[model samples]
Target chain A: MARLITWCYKNHWMTLTLLFAPLLLHGQVNCLIYDAASGERIACELSLRAIQYRQGSRNSQLLFDKAIEVGPKFAWAYYEKSVPFFKRGLLAEGVSLINKAIDLEPKNYLYYRAYWYFYNRSYAHCIEDLEELYTVHHESFTNTPGGEMEMRMILAMAYAQSGEVEKGIEWAQHLMDTYKEQPHLKGQYDHHILGVLYYLNNRPLMAAAQLEKQLEVNARLADTHYYLGLINRENTNSTLAQLHFKKAWAKLQGEGGGHSPNIFEGFNVSAQDIEGML
Target chain B: MRPVSYLPLIILLLTFSTFACLQSQANHQPKYKIPIVTHDLSYIPFDPLLDDPNFQICDSTKISSGRNRLQYAAGRNTLRSDIVSRFSPQSAYESFNGYIVIRFLANCKGQTGRYRAASLHLDFSPAQAPSNLEQHAKEVVMGLNNWSRATETNANAEYSKFINLKIKNGKIDHVVL
Candidate 1:
């Protein structure tokens, strides 16, 4: 009777082990083989890349949701996922996602850089990013060919957009004077900014000439046409103004058959209306 | 009997545990998100006259000069020819006076295929008009037809360059002059 009892106890415990062994192995693999947090972050990054490749906001949102599900702490996923929301004109969601990213990585320059642009709604954030990049690696700006010059131009534009017109103009002029003869930097963004500065200074002819030369080099630039059209319209050259307007319209329509609500509010004349006038 | 009985329970436990772990890990895995970037291209306008089929103009005064009109017609013809030749393949040019009118056709192959002229009215304008005016108009039409056929035959030899021609309301809007 003692031997039977001992055997029975051993058999019962063995049965329990057998019943639970698969669960133990599964838990071990989950803990050891796959790190949930890291996997979620990677998925978020991949989903963002896929969004760019696919050009569909829906796909991006789906991927972003997947990333968040996999890793709730993945800040980059939130940041990347916000892009589609912003693009789809869901500003509220974009703000939330960007805020979430900033919360996760408060000290990260990239997160701050993104927030600065999306929140401030100006080019200042780009300047901030450049400045931060310079701070992190001074040599990247100083030693690299054309890097310093490019950063200066970007800073000038940012300043201009930020309502510091005088400072922007001063920086632009300084760049032009320093790099006037430099083959690599001459006729770059400096010229464009200088043209804008001239227009602001009430020098229409000079502004028109500078913008025209830039347009010649980059015909597809919508902003150049916009400026040129404004100058021409102000000067009472309706034909020239109409030409620029048409060019701008074509470029904007090509983007997706709709004007960018932010930039092209003034020049949103319908094709039929223009034809009627013509 | 004891060893065999124990084997079944061990196998069952291992399989169940593995599945359970997998399910739990799946639940714990975090999700990922993507970032957005926007790239925009600028716009350019296209010429509207290139696609207009009825972009023709006629000059009645020159055609009325009769035999002397040939020189005028010839001059106008040459100018029209030059314009047609210079025009991109996707355009056409037609110029006319009362006594003489010239039409030139350009195709996608960058070849000017046909040149047509009409002088029927030139001989008919006077009370006693020349008998050959009908023949002259006929000749002009024949010449244009022949040229068009030749162009079609040699079209394969030229490089294909496609350009979108803008037409509005079935009319030619602008001439590059």
Candidate 2:
């Protein structure tokens, strides 16, 4: 190894290649894992101890408090301490704790804060964090922490929910276009959200086209058929609407449940909802 | 020159490896742990209580019916809308917009009570709304007598639910279940 080092030192090209290796690796790596310093990483272990106790219990929260005190810069401690507060309806306390964590390490904790923002029905705030995470910080996303749906899906859906249906269509369309040829790699119901957005935009032709593609990608997603049925009815195609609604109802009640309910889903057609339509 | 001239380079490469391996190790480990621990030597139990004096959790074991309980939740989304429609115009409160999260329990016989509530701004910071805002929400929630008693393994089961209401311009805009 020493001989190779000497040879590399002798050749400027070899020396330059050796120097660039770390930078090359850095580009390919997800920033969150490598963003922490070794000291903060050790501090996060204290949080692990806290979680071993029952969540939201006195002991667990105390341990989390201790972790925060001992490793004040360790963002995970603040993030961990905020969780129970969020779950138990202490939104202010939860938001304060998570904000500290995000301030310490924005890349890692922004997704979590955005997730609660979505739940709290603060669609604008959710969009702000996600837009920052995606556009400003350039963080690549796969799903929310709960594995419900892609963050892009959340972005597009939030746009629609926030009354920005045009932006929603642009974004959802962009996501589908990116993964169009690769069906398996698409989000669990990316096409469904797009189809719903199209229907909401009053473009029944595009809506029907997206729903047709949705049937091919995720036939089991009952909400897809439910929205498809609504579109068919809107277009005065009662026969197809009836057919789609029946499919939606059957798929909704089937053994596996066409699609397991997701909190982040753009649309969920409940049995009660379908009953009225049927 | 000695081989030690490259020591900094080697150390830099090793440091890079350390950063790469560290959090990925946490990712590989199963995060699931039995979370029902009663005590630990290092534990210092001190959690603030936000509950009515008469309220007590009926079951801790299945308490996490938690997410599953959401499936059987009754009148959450619907009742919230009714409260806004019936009560909003009558009360001349200050214009306020944010969330009101109410945490309470339902007992085995479909009895519900013990409400603890918090109000927050849209960005989720602590904020004050008109007293009537929270009062009206609590009244509607307490008036609800139709909650279904859900039991997975037994007939009598008690549970807790958090009802999050988003208020916009002094009216209940959305109910988050």
Candidate 3:
């Protein structure tokens, strides 16, 4: 013991550094993070962001797969892998992966969001997940800007789709009013979505008004023109309908054209309606 | 040699063994290394919200998957360059402008086949029309076979894409896909 003390004293700086190394190293570590598999976790997050931005779903899938291979116990990897599958229209594979994710971590609210809200398109199930996250846990997704608004939008859409049009309108109206003056928050509030909700409520005039308001903001969209055309056609205004439809077709041939058919547009207006009626 | 003389050697061996054991234990323990993120700017994806006009449904507006859009854009740019090299500006009326619309199926394998060209419209208003401008445009378009292959996530599905070329003053003005 005396000899050891003498040696430490002789090399005090080195000894001190050795003694404090573990403390300094571990200080920045997040307790919530899986310390054993941080590399995989980072790769997983990068892959998720890439896929979300449409960077390359196939590459993202491979990255997710690699993450899972490295950290087999990571529940988020399975959840993320399911996203690419869903994007690719492989619903069965996506559902299976989501189920696995939920099974691995039953407490994860995002797993439920992916399965119920995004994949199933069941408003009730989506609402249940949101309610559970907001009421019971309140630990997920409340910190980000517009997170609360997004929750409200989902709930409003859910209510509208579930035959509670009045409740849905209440939420939708609140959203629109809140973001009305904040034109920069266009990423959050969508007039087309609000217009669709009004249409679902069987108020065609109100729907047209909402969509026209969007056009006033920006009229460069062919989809909006086509939608207005459909609304006018429904109102039996052949002249306005034809005008909008012709404009839509002309815009479709413009510089930024060749977009996919709107899934929602298929609900009221068919491709035949555009080609034939126009 | 005296027995005490071997004690120093024994202590040195013990010290070495201890260090080996400590390293092995460290190898088995959980290591938390900070992650490093490197962004590659070359593979940036297209933002569809700019084109789709439906910013609210941004996720659904994704017509093409991932790097395919970037590749498609690159291909269209190449097509414009190709047309510029082939199309003879002197053959058309001075300052003449027109558009040629062509539709083709880009199959799952990223191969284009069975191209169907639409009727060519010449917009030489006050300027006299060239006799064989339509034929020249058709030949130029039909000669194009070099294209960047599109990647589709859905198994064995074909995608049909339209290529619109705006020709002005006997040179390709813009190529829209």
TM-score of chain B of each: 0.18, 0.57, 0.43
DockQ of 2: 0.14
- Residues B1-177, candidate 3, lDDT per residue (tens digit)? 655688889999999999999999988832111111122111122245422222122122233433143244344446666766887767544455554544444444544443433323231011233555555665676677665545544544444344545556655655533
lDDT of 1 by residue, A120-184 (tens): 23354545554554445442222111121244455555666667767766766766675546543
* Candidate with best DockQ: 2
- Say which candidate scores most in lDDT: 2
Q: Give residue B177's error in model 3 in angstroms.
A: 21
In order of DockQ, best first, we have 2, 3, 1
Give TM per candidate.
Answer: 0.34, 0.74, 0.42
Model 2 agreement with the true structure over A87-198: per-residue lDDT tens digits:
7676777788888888877887788888888776788999999888878888754466655456777888888889999898887776667665754346556767777888
- Those runs of model 3 whose alpha carbons end farther than 4 Å from true positions after fitting are A1-75, A99-164, A180-183, A230-237, A252-269, B1-177
Error of 1 at A57 (Å): 6.6
How many clashing residue pairs, candidate 2?
0
Candidate 2's C-alpha runs over 4 A off are A1-42, A180-184, A254-256, A259-266, B1-91, B107-111, B155-158
Task: Tell me which residue pairs clash in candidate 2.
Answer: none
Q: Comparing only chain A of model 3 with the true chain A, what is the TM-score?
A: 0.56
The order of the candidates by lDDT, greatest first, is: 2, 3, 1
